[model samples]
Target: MAPVTNGRVLFNAIPEDYPVPGKTVVYDTTETIDFENVPLNGGILIKVLLLSLDPYMRGRLRAPEIESYMPAFPLGEPLTGGGIGVVLRSENDAVKAGTHVRGWLAHQQYYIAPNLSMLEVIDRDSKLDWSVYIGAAGMPGETAFAGWREYSEAKKGEVAFITTGAGPVGSMVIQIAKQDGVKVIASAGSEEKVKFMREIGADVVFNYKTTDVREVLKKEGPIDIYWDNVGGDTLDAAMEFAAKHSRFIECGQISGYNQGYQPMKNPGLIFAKCMHFHGFLLAVLRPKHSAAFQAEVVPKLVSGEYKFTEDISHGLDKVGDVLLAIQKGTNKGKAIVRVADE
Candidate 1:
């Protein structure tokens, strides 16, 4: 009978470099929703519990005219990304009230999903936390799994190098490589992150900020597999020291996402070494590898054999700040915004 506050994080402007919290993205609470009276139209009304803020979202903040893999964020609208929520009302038989769902959701406190095809119904009684679905057990986890399983084919005892190694995807990459007996050399931005990489089983870990990445690679490398997340100078260095017939998984280029395209100093090394360099989209790979990833990884996650670090901040207002932190590689592990407690 009463209207409830429905807060939202809206995209306000296209940033020249990094998005500015409260300016480029604004938190608006002026909107109100009649929760009980809202129309579902053969779908569901959800109370958003959590939202995943990954590095890939940075590319979505550009002008609508600019074409890319994912569509640009429409100005003055709620930003959308991978999130988990609880359904309060449903008009569809497949989805019922009180069920938990995971999918791409608008960055708002509450939303009405008119379509159920993309949204997945998750068990509400699962032991894993809701936030995990948006991070280690979700898209980021899948990306890391696919990258290592399909792209990086380093044999046991061979060295594998992973950039941005403490974050969600890289952390998974590190653990997967270790499980297969591959020696992992990983880099992070801070000492804390370097420590985290070691804890996750990276054989050789270093704070790329303090130690020269190029020098470290030269000593620890001639790497058989290079899983690159930050692709500017670090990638250039990896190319220089990469072993003959090395496999390079070009996952993300967060280092230059805000600064624009960064040219490689020696891309010719790929040809000279007869290396395998591949860039993949998770959307393309998930259909092929998701079932296996879930079956193999989820059990390990539950048993505590595999670890995932989550950097969580609360409130809808924090979405902009979290995304900015992700782009700069400042947040630890998988950065998530806890919108509401489940």
Candidate 2:
């Protein structure tokens, strides 16, 4: 067979603020690969079907010298993240052709999986949509599940405040808390998102763009649990209304991801309120909680008992745009980009 086009999203340059498509990240369509001639080298050739566009990816667009939990994106290379794909050819005995896989995958239509340690073969008989493996049933969903179980010491009838409640992590957090009989007060950036949050079981939902977060919290909250997703000011206000010994699950801070660092206004509240402010890493928690999460949530997802929303964009060109939307809090749900059809 002749060489086929291999489109990819490349990290072109580091950004000071929000990454700009075409400049900071580029959708390059110049590359190609011959299916017949490409060497397997004890690896497998995969056709990527879905790629997750997440808020945390913004942290990866940095100078290589600076270190974090994850490495910076090397310039002039494709971005990589949680993805779902099908193996088209395999030289490795453990991986067979025509099987679906979920793991760290490149931001391209085609990829070569040289290391199989990180890859997990998905069940083909499940009959689930490929997007589910990259969105609702994926990293973002697991992050919410593991984070809540590890941090939230929630009590029945307690008030819980969740910022970014319509998002993948926040949406799941809202439902999980409600199931445990916790009253939830959550916020979103748009009216549509606010409505979605309410439908998913938030006792009180508001548009942060049109309403004041502090005012809403004052009226309905003396929060016992704070599921924090955005950190700058909303976090401060949640602290103001926090019940003594409140548990704070410090997740991603999308608010500060694109801007210069802004210190919290009253961090001393941590001591005064005796708040258990804990930040978590998904990588550390995933291995411990993955099986439990699948057992508990997968059936619910299949039965439509667990509700979710996916803000998906199609094509490799949409990666940068969707990622930018995630940083700005404009996306309605778990941001994803579809690269190919199964």
Candidate 3:
């Protein structure tokens, strides 16, 4: 084993102003670990290949007092999130060198983990691409499955509506629902996204920005399940059209992240419809249902029963721009930063 230097980007604070760009600074540091000196409990070094830039990362950029499921990234440290990397040198037999793995960790060129239990060994025999591990086969895919299965309890032949249909998680929800014989009604921000939704098997897709959601959903008939990724007006409109005993999975609220906070305007619809509105966090699901998810959902993805779209940005330096683009709803699919190639 040889000495190696790693470069990483650190997030310092949250932006106070709307459309205020978040700050990231890249710096280099050296590692001191050799095969002979590797700690008994220490895992070896890894070189990150792909990093996920999700809407949740915005929440982490805020201060700790915000008190979300995930704590805020501390100032003067590398920001952490879900990522795919290849093990370079490992003292732990469970995570051998040369294996590609996905884990929750700091955003960096390389990481040194002391037997991080959060890291999982990716099956190299699988035909899925490495990027899929960070996208459909990884956290986003699991989030979609857990949210739908545990919260919505969706059934066949029912109508499922998803906001932000063009996004990675939303798109997968549409496909999974359709595969299970559920009819899907989806809403995206643009015409191109509407078309993309249809291409991915959304039964009916609408441009929410231009079209009236209440009108479009009404024409599509009753919505039995509503996966609300966009909050505020889109959520309000979805509630209005929901059928009796409808299931609403509140996975995210990207619509209000930039605008600070907006009051909910349609509380009456929930009562009228008897809708089951539930909020979901993926980190929580990991402990509660990870085994079931790996057994049930991972196979579907590996077998091609589920499809995914990647909205990848090249280079680590562009991570700030990619996060900004995703927040603005510019990225078409799962926004990822390609740090290196496997």
State TM-scores per candidate: 0.97, 0.97, 0.89
lDDT, each prediction: 0.89, 0.88, 0.79
lDDT of 1 by residue, 133-183 (tens): 887888988999998899777688999999888989999999989989999
Candidate 3 structure quality by residue, lDDT tens digits, 183-221: 899888888898888988998888887888889887985
Ranking by TM-score: 1, 2, 3
Clashing pairs in 2: none
lDDT, residue 176, candidate 1: 87
Q: Model 2 over residues 54-173: C-alpha lDDT tens digits? A: 888999999999988889999999999988899999998888989989999999999999968778898732645778777668787898889988889878999999989999889888
Candidate scoring better on lDDT of 2 and 3: 2
Model 2 lDDT, full chain set? 0.88
lDDT of candidate model 3 versus the reference: 0.79
- Candidate 2 deviation (Cα RMSD): 1.3
